[model samples]
Target chain A: MKIYEFAQAPNCRRVRMFLAEKGIKMEYVHVDIGKGENLAEDYRRRDPNAKVPVLELDDGSHIAESVAIQRYFEEMHPEPPLFGRDAKEKALVEMWTRRGDFNMMFNVGMCFQHTTGFFSDRMRVFPEFGEESGKKAVQFFSVLDQHLEENRYLVGDYFSVADIGMLCSLDFGKAVKLRPDPAQYPNLVRWREELNARPSASA
Target chain B: MKIYEFAQAPNCRRVRMFLAEKGIKMEYVHVDIGKGENLAEDYRRRDPNAKVPVLELDDGSHIAESVAIQRYFEEMHPEPPLFGRDAKEKALVEMWTRRGDFNMMFNVGMCFQHTTGFFSDRMRVFPEFGEESGKKAVQFFSVLDQHLEENRYLVGDYFSVADIGMLCSLDFGKAVKLRPDPAQYPNLVRWREELNARPSASA
Candidate 1:
C-alpha cells in the first residue's frame, strides 16, 4: 500500500501516528501542499476533495479521510487495536475521536486557514471566523482537561485513536498559537506531555 | 436503550434514520434545544458537549456523536448493514460519511448558526461567515451531484450511512435555503428525490 500525505498536516500526522502505533509500514508518497500539487487533476482523481492523507491499497483503490484510513488499517490489523476491543469500547473510542475532531482538530484547522490565509489562493478566509474558531479550540481544552483529570486517556485507561486524534489536534493547535495554558488546564497540559513523549509522537 | 435528541437536529436525525432503517425501536427522550434544556447541568453530564442524539445504553452509560451511536447500532444489529458488507466497502462508506460531515453537514450547520443566528443568544454570529458557509455547502452539492451521476448511492449501489448523512445534511440545508438546483445539480436532485421516497426519510 502507498499513502499520499503531506508531512506536518494534522490529518496526515494522524494516519502516521496510527501506523507507528500498530508497527505497520507502507510506502509513503508525499503530496506537497506547499506547491499546490494536491490540487492538480491527477491528485484530485485519487481524492475528489483534493485532501492529503489518502491511502492507496495494492488493488489501486484509494481511501480518503484520515479516520477512515485508520479504520481500514484497524480492520486489517486487529492486534493492538486503536479503535476498541468490543462494542461499548468501540463506541467510547469513536465518541472521543469525534469529539477531538469537532472540538479541536476542525476548529484549529479553521483558525489557521481563516487567520493565516494559508491557502487563501484556493479558498476564502474570514478573519473573524478564524479568531472565533481559535477561541473555540481553546475552550475545548478546558473540557478535555476536566475529562483527563480522572481518566488516564481520552477513553479511560486505554490508548486509542481518540488519544491519537487529540495529539494531532493539539500539535496542530500550535499553528494558530492555540495552546492550553498550564495554570488553567493542568490535566490537559500533563496529558499532552505524556503523549508527546510517546515514540509515535515523532512520527 | 434511550436516545436523547432534538427532533429537528440534523445529527440527531441521522441516528433516527439509521434506527428506522434497521427497524429497531428505542425509548426517545426529547431534549428541546430551542428551550435551552440541553444546556442544563444534568444534560451536560450526559454529554459534555451538550449536543443532542446521545444514546444511553442499557448499562446506563451513554455514547455521544451520531456516527458512534450508529456504530453501536450497527454492531448490535448486523442485518441490512448500513456501514458495509466487507472491508473495502466499509472504507468507502466511511470515506463518504466523513465527506458528508465535512463538506456538507458541517457547512450547512455553520450557515444556519451564523446566518439564522438560531443560537445567537449563546454564541457569536457572523453573517459573512454564515453566507460563506452557505456558498461552500452549495459548492459541495455539485461535488455530490457528480459522484451520484456515476453511483446509485454515496458509496456505491447499496445504501449506507453515507446516504443517511447526505440526506440529513440536505434536509438541514433547507434551514439555510441551500438546496441543489435541478438545473445545476441534476444528479444530486435525483438522488435526494429517491432518498426522500424511503420510509426512513421521515425519521
Candidate 2:
C-alpha cells in the first residue's frame, strides 16, 4: 500500500499515527501541498478532491478521508483495535471521533486557512471567519477538557481513533495559536501531555 | 429507542432516512432548535453539544452524530446494510460519506449560519464567508457529478449511506439556494432525481 500525504497536515498525521499504532509499514509519498503538487492532474486523478493522505491499497483502489483510512487499517489489523470491539463501543468511538473532526480539527484547519492565508494562492482567505473559527476551536477545547476530566480517553478506558483525532486537532491548533491553556483546560492539557509521550503520537 | 431531532436539519434527516430504509421504528421527539429548546439544561445533559439527532437507546443511553447513529442501527439490523458488506466496501462507503459531509453538508450549513444568521441568537454571522461557502458547495457538486458519471453509486453498484448523505446534503442545499444545476452538474442532477424518488428520501 502507498499513502500520498503532507507530513505536517493534521489529516495526514491522523493516518500516519494510526499506521504507527498498528506497527504497519507502507510506502509514503510526500505530496507538496504548499507547492500545489496535490492539485496536479495525476494526483487529482487519484483523488478528485486533491486532498492529502490518499491511501492506495494493494489492489490499486484508493481511500480518501483520514477516518476512512483508519477504518481500513482497523479492519486489516484488528488487534489493538482503534475503533471498537462491539456495536455500542464502535458507535461511541465514532461519535467522539466525529465530534473531534467537526468541532476541533475542522475548525482549527479553517482558522489557519482563513487567518494565515496558508493556501491563499489556491483559495480565498477570510480573516474575519478565521478569527471566529479560532474562537470556536478554543471553545471546543473546553468541551474536550470537560470530557477528558472523566474519561481516560475520548470514549472510555481504551485508546481509539477518537484520541488520535483529538491529538491531531490539538497539534494543528498550534498553527493558529489555539493551543489549550493549561490552567483553563487542565484535563485536556494533561491528556495531551500523556498522548504526546506515546511513540505513535509523534508519527 | 427515541430520537431528538429537528425535522429539516440535514444531519437529523440523514438518520431519519436511514431508519426509514431499515424499516426501524423509533419514538421521535422534536427538538425545536430554532427556539433554542436544544439548549435547555436537560438536553445539554443528554448531549453536551446540544446538537439535534441524538438517539436515545432503549437503555436510556444516547448516541450523537448522524453517522454514528446510523452505524448503531446498521449493526443492530445488518439487512439492507448502509455501511457495507466487506472491509473495502465499507471503507469506500465511509470515504464518500465523509466527503459529502465535509464538502457539501458542512459548507451548506456554514453558508446558512453565516448568511442567514439562522442561529444569530447564539453566534456571530459573516456574509462574506457565507457567500464563499456557497460557492464551495457548488464546486463540490461538480466533483460529485464527475464521480457519479463513472459510477452507479458513490462507491460502486449498491446504494449506501453515502447516497443518503448526498441526499441529505442536497436537500439542505435548498436552504441556501444552492441546488445542483443540470447544465453544470448533470450527473449529480440525475443522481439526486433518482434518490429523491426513493420513499426514504422524504423521511
Candidate 3:
C-alpha cells in the first residue's frame, strides 16, 4: 500500500499517525500542495477531490477522507482498533470524531481561508467570509472546552480517533492564531497534553 | 425512540427517510432552530453541539451526526440495509456517503450558516462565513455532477445512505441560490429524479 501525503496538513498528519500507531508500513509519496502539485491532472485522477492522504490499497483501489482512511486501515489491521470493538463503542468514537470534524477541524480551515488570505491566490473569492471562520473557531474552542471537562478523551475514557483528529487540527490552529487558552479550557489543556505525550502524536 | 428534528434541515430529514424506508416507527420532537431553541440548556444536554437530527435511543443515550444516526439505526434493524453489505460494498457506501458529507452536505451547512445568517445568533457570533459557505456548496455540486456522470446512484445501482445524504441537501441548496445548473449537471438531474422516484427519497 502507498499513501500520497502532505507534511503540514492536519488531515494528512492524521493518516500518517494512524499508520504509525497500527505498525503498518506503506510507501509514502509526498504531494506538494503548496507548489500546486495536487492540482495537476495526474494527482487529480488519484483522488478526484485532489486532497492529500489518499491510501492506495494493494488491490489498486483507494480511500479518501482522513476519518475514512483511518477506518480503512483499522479494518485491514485490527490488532489495535482505534475505532473500538462493539457497535455502540464505535458509534461513540464516531460521535466525537464528527464533533471534532464539524467544530474544530472544519472551523480551523475557515480561520485560515477567511482571515489570513494565505490561500487566496489558490482560491480568493471568499474574502468576505474569511474572518467569520476565525471567530467560529473561537466558538468551537468553547464547546470543546466543555466536552473535555468531563471526558478524558473526546468520546469517553479511552484515547481514540477523536483525539487524533482534534490534536492535529488544533496544532495547525496555532499557525492561524487559535490556541487553547489554559484559562478558558482546562479540560482541553489536560487532553491536549496527554495527546502530546504519545510518540506517534508527533506525526 | 424519539427524534428531535426540523423539516427544513436535510440532516434531520435523513433520519426520517431512514426510518420510513425501514418501516420503523418513532415519535418526532421538532426543535425550532430558527428560534434558537437548540441552544437552550434543555436541548444542549441532549446534544452539546446544539445541532439537530438527534436520536434519543431506547437506552436513553443520544446520537448526533446524521451518518452516526444512520449507522445506529441500520445496526438495530439490518434488513434491507441502507449501508451496503460486505467489506467492499460497505466501503463503497461509506466512500460516497462521506463525499456527500464533505463535498456536499457539509458545504450545505456552511451555505446556510455562513451565508444565510438564519441562525447566526444561536450558532455563534459571526454571519459572514455564510457567503463563503454558499460558494463552497456550489463548488461541491460540480464535484457531485462529475461523479453522477459515471455512477447511477452515488455508489452503486441501488439506493443507499449516500443518496439520502445528497438528495435532501441539494434540494435544500436550491433555497440558497446554490442550485446546480441543469445544463452543466445533466447527470445530477437524472440521478435527482431517479432518487426522488423512490418512496423514501422525499423524506
lDDT of 3 by residue, B19-110 (tens): 88888888989788888888899898899778898888888889887778777778778888888765556666767777777777776776
**TM-score, one value per model:** 0.98, 0.98, 0.92
- Model 3 steric clash pairs: A114-A130, B114-B129, B114-B130, B115-B130
Q: How well does candidate 3 reproduce the true complex, by DockQ?
A: 0.48
Decoy 1 TM-score against native: 0.98
Q: Model 3, stretches more than 4 Å misplaced?
A: A125-128, B120-132
Docking class of 3: acceptable
Residue pairs in clash, model 1: none
RMSD of 1: 1.1
Candidate 3 residue B121 Cα shift, in angstroms, is: 4.2
Per-residue lDDT of candidate 3, residues A33-137 (tens digit): 888898899888778888897878789887777777777767678878887666677767777777777777777887776677666668754544555666777
TM-score computed on alpha carbons, candidate 2: 0.98
Comparing 2 with 3 on TM-score, the higher-scoring candidate is: 2
* lDDT for position A56 in model 3: 81
Q: Tens-digit lDDT track for model 2 on A1-203?
A: 89999999999989988999999987999899999999999998889999988999888878999888888888878888889878998899989999988898888988999899889999989898889988988888888899899998888798889999889988888888788889999999999999989999887
